[model samples]
Target: MDDAHRTRWTRRTLDWLRTEVGSALLLVGVVLVALAWANSPFSGAYEHLWELPVHVDAGDLRFDMDLHHWVNDGLMVLFFFVVGLEVRQELAVGALRQRNRRLVPLVAGALGVLTPAAVYLVIAGRDAPTGWGVVIGTDTAFLLGVLALVGPAMSNQLRIFLLTLSVVDDFIAVTVIGTVYSDDVRPGPLVLAAACLLALWLLGRAREWRSTPYVLVVVVLWGATVQAGVHPSLAGMLAGLLVPAASPEREDVVRAKHLFRSYWQSPNAGVARVVGLGLARSISVNHRLHEQLRTPVSLVVVPVFAFANAGIDLRGGALGEAFGSTVLWGVVAGLVAGKLVGISLGAWAAVRAGLGELPDGVGPGSVVGGAALSGIGFTVSLLIADLAFEDEADTQAAAIGVLVAMVLSSLVGAFAFRVARVRFGEHSADLPVTLTPDVDVERDHLRGPAGAPYTVVEYLDFQCPFCARATGMGQDLADHFGDQIRYVVRHLPLEDVHPQAFGAALAAEAAHRQGAFWEMHDVLFANQARLEPDDLRGYALELGLDVERFDRDMADETLAERVRAHAESARASGAQGTPTFFLNGVRNQGSHDARTLIAALEESLPEAAVRRRS
Candidate 1:
């Protein structure tokens, strides 16, 4: 190569090296720090740093958490947030967009996740199933690092395939972390987290995607997550997803147009307008923080987290004990066995049933090999291990098993792909499948008189006290407005805490069968405090329904299915909780009195009045 070509080549090589080397170094640094802190003479100080008391209070609002918990629960949320972003990006434009490419990785990931989990469970048993999640994640950095070292031996297609698989793996891991390893239930913190997320999203949409508000919101969300008995890392995932990642070039153009308009409208305005002008001058200022948030999270947050949590001291026969322990073995087995079995079965079923086809340039052997690699569960496994085992020794053992399983799975996956490449001769073809975002909405109930000018949609959960209040108020509005406003009640039961919510919903549907829906609706809301099955039936009889019909319908599969469909619809419409309202298709998801709803209804009315001409 010539001197100029050499220079260009060297620079390009350095850039690639930087990315690979930087990520590796960061991962190594985290492990070293964690190991050092866990075993060092200054371990106390290291632990204390994480345990230091941090508090934020404004008037009556005050919250606190130790340093370590903040990092684990709070900072980890940001990690998950980034995970969500990657997922959204992949679905929008990456490997996940193609059905063929997507299916194989998904199948591979499913197998990878299940096998290890099964291995862990069979070893650990039902009591330790929580630890199953521990052996169910793929460590993106470590896995990618291994691939980079193998370099030229691996094809670019394989590398992309691995990346896509890892992204899906991360998605599953974060979900497990959020749903499975969560703390006890509390509405206050949950509500706060929801509000913060909404605020951040609105700020982004209004072109006010500044870092300050986002950061503040994240902190509050973290605190709320801690308070809500959920792993605080969930807040990070929520915040990250809401932060837009449109390029700086586009942002600059938008900002310039906005500023020009503002200046044109107020030529003679004083310093106040000029200061306001400064705010509009650069969308860069506002967007700079959000951009930083995304970059640092991947480069710093995730790596540090991996290092801190991944380290386990391997002295005093800890390795031997880990192998001996059923919990450890269970985790290892679940990841290895469950992943392979579940994934292979799911894939085979999909293909045989004609629901999906294998990817091009990929064969059954490659798929199986990839499935083996999918058994490499590290990140999520550790998280679940932390949750499942309160005993330090047990936890360490599970971690050791995870580390071993991950390495073995990755090796198996890489080898499998290599064999497939040799056999299939790189005939890459896209798989055929339907990929649609899952809609969780219930659309079964009466949608109001066909072309009614106004539609009032109410989200109600049988267990929520606020929803009960809204039910009574909604009925009043419906009666008063008559033909002017059509009322539509949507199911949105909070099932996580209230286990019987679905049953309660079924009871309401049963009453509806006997032409006493509004009456049963009132009774359910009125007596939300005491919603036993018998109580619901009693209310049905009091409302003049045939008691036998109500009982039969309550147990009816058709009625239950309809209720479930409605609940799904509510979720799709963004109804996170009960007592949410919507006026003529516009969302109004929260508690509001009759007057407030009326005002909203009037806003949608036409300017011209209807007249009776003689």
Candidate 2:
């Protein structure tokens, strides 16, 4: 095959691996392979391989660790770095951006961790208190995969709740490992580590998106932390947080454009390279690193860690040894029973006491199921088991408990998710969607009167052929119902699938400024197949819009953000696809034909409200 085909195939494969189900399956498969290898006659090979040691010394610099330690203490740092990046993104722009919005997850996750650890301490305290931390984590990839297995009956709320909970869980786990579990923490090295962190912060400001100084500082930070007897992986979080999450300055974007134009016009190799560098700086460093590392971490680093760590011999009475033992059963109880009770009750108390609220569409049964699934604490639990136990027997027994807990937890979670799907009748997860035609009348385009009794809100991509099918529905709604129902258009562009969708939305938005949004909207949908950049400008001219102002408005990044915010609002409010409609604040699912739209309007709107057109 050609290089292009090979590159495309590689991209597809990496994307697949980065998905929840794909990562989960790969992780589980590696674990299975490890189990099989450890149990087979070739078990000696597995043990010997992980036990192999490597050492490095260069003048004053020295590093020594075994293959297993390297995987756990060394490679796992990248995994934690990715976690830090995710948390930063959430706090910076995603769901947890707002303080009140963050409260629920923070409360739920805090309770989730404390309850599990408390349960473990109560049950295993006298004999195995150290194992408390083992039950405190939730494996995000595995939990998400389990949810995926339950099918679309799972709502986005459950996914978000679980994800937020896991991010918090990981943070707690790392902090616990670094502070509570480290037996030899020295203040001197810790002070040095803090100095390195200061250096990291300074370097980040001086050279945004430059990895060299950051890497050097992080390397020293890791060594210092290791010397200080804290888990070296904590250095990764420190490094990750230093990477900026905000958008770059406009000058940066302008510089990138200049470089790109220079490269295009002059066609020099150096200019082309500078263009690449400039464009990289224009994007958020957190996002760029996250994307660059996700595939490799999911496909390579995680699987290797799982393979090295998950190998517990099932042969030679190992099952009997663990099944009959208190340490094993205590861990199982803590993970399975403790997580379920903790997440459920913790969330309940938080919600009841006004600290948190249940996510939309998620009822008690779904919460119970989700809580049970959080018990599948594979990655961090295994790490805890390693840290908490010195004896091989104890470690293997804890591993067995982790394995059993994971299996049982999944079954329980699936059962709960299925129950939720049946109880809620599949639509329980969707939030109520409403759009006030008068609210964003100036910001968004409106075809009919803002105060029409029955306002029809259409969330759609301009390039969507299905949206094109619904194009006539708007005019027909006006034609049939007259002023009784006014049509309002909102952009929900899917730029990945349709490259021109965002540009089309921008064209429509720009036209709204010139009081001709409907005109641009009509033409764009009609000729979606030809919405190139120049075609959009031509459409503005054809519609008699101020061409220069239209161009300036289209070029406005803030307008793009407005369009993006609208799309995100559409998603968060549970508009599943393009051509989604809401009549009188209620979503109208199914066919978007005029008849369906009219029928939905009749069913959803009160007669008094409909009669308000007079």
Candidate 3:
């Protein structure tokens, strides 16, 4: 090569290297500073800062929470809010805008989420498997950072594909975090958060408030949320969504340019230049800021979170023990095996059914491989681990499980991509696929006895106050309907929040063994607050049971198993919360009044009443 050509190439390479190094340094600095602050002698101060109490009052309800909790629970809402914005944006204008573009990522993401969870469940079973949701997320920033290091060796399309998949992965993670990882909520903080979000929307519409004011309000909302027992990071996601992504005067720039062109030949050329330049400059600055606001959140917030949460203690026998844990193995299997299997099967089925297609240069092998990689759940997995296991040992085990699964999935994905590249030579057309038809088969089956017109399914947690309220409403509905509806009581005990819920369920099942399920169910719901292990005997005696038989049944493993089976069935039927009702076999979550119950039952009934012939 000529000397001038070499010099030019070297300069360009050097500049690119400089930019990459600069970003790396900034990331490293943040990580180092956070670690130092967290581990230093001044760590107590850092911890104390998060623990500082903040209080808010609205009428009769007063709420307060510590600073650390505010950041995790409340601020994180904004994190999810931004995530929602990204998902919306992707569906509207980005890679996922097309069916073919979406299929690969969607299928891959589903596999990523489901596999790790299933693996976790299989390894840990019902009790310990609660953490299954934890190991089903992908850290987009880390994945992109790794990709960036590979530079031009990676295809531009592949980069875009990876980014799109990661964004979708983030959406799934945020939804899981919001729905699955929450505690029994207090109405005060929830209402406050909603009000704040509404206020933010109004401010955006007014377009008068600066981002600083919004940020401050967000901090306050975070504080309220922390006191409310919610993870605070959600507040950040909510706030980000309310921040405007486009300025009000975006159209004015085009109008001004056209007006300036007309003025170029007129007598007011000098004045036009001055006014047009000023307006253009202002518009440019506003547009730039607005664009920055709309930049992908996965690039910023996720990386910061990973840095903060990813640090392992790495001392004692903790590392070895984590590796040895079934929880960890379960997480690994779920992410690595379950994700690959579920995603591939779902995608193949979709293709065969004629509903979707694959991306250009991507094949089934590549898609499945990428799906496997998507199972590298790091962020959401850790959050689930925190929610699922209160024990420190269990938490560590889950973390190890997440770490292992992520590493395995990433390696597998990279290898698969390489293999696809070699074999397919990077095909440039999108591959199409078909989706399976959705049928109400489960709904039909749950209707009970071939000719049953309507099925009413009630999901109740033994310790829920709302479930107690629902018990009375449900009884009234059954009596009012009078053999018109089949009431199927499903156990759904919120065990994490109510420690005695499972025990109460066991007592109810024991009562069922003596053909007095309704009597026991009503008694248990009515006296949910007073239920103790000893209290079951008194209830059994009042119901005129064989006290010995009742006691024996209460202690029976079979009773506990039955309760667990009911709980699992409720979950599979999409009942996440207590007092969830399903009319005509359709799930309806949350407590309702007698009027609402009547309405639901009425809707479920056949249009024509069946007449019985005596």
Q: Give each model a TM-score.
A: 0.55, 0.73, 0.53
State the lDDT of candidate 3 residue by residue for 83-170, as single tens digits.
5455545654467766766775576566556665667787876547567667666655445444444222433445565566666566
What is residue 40's positional error in candidate 2, in angstroms? 0.8
Best model number under TM-score: 2
Candidate 2: stretches off by over 4 Å: 1-12, 151-154, 204-207, 248-251, 426-488, 491-614
Local distance difference test, per candidate?
Answer: 0.65, 0.80, 0.62
Could you give candidate 2's per-residue lDDT for residues 186-285 as a string of tens digits?
Answer: 8998999999989877766766585556667777888888778789767777677776676455467757878888988999888888888889888887
Our tally of clashes for model 3 stands at: 46
Note each model's CA RMSD in angstroms: 19.6, 11.6, 25.3
Residues 384-433 of candidate 1: C-alpha lDDT, one tens digit per residue: 67776777888888887877777676676667656665776533322211
Q: Which stretches of candidate 1 lie over 4 Å from their true place?
A: 1-22, 36-63, 95-104, 107-112, 151-156, 159-168, 200-216, 243-291, 340-369, 421-614
Q: Which one wins by lDDT: 2 or 3?
A: 2
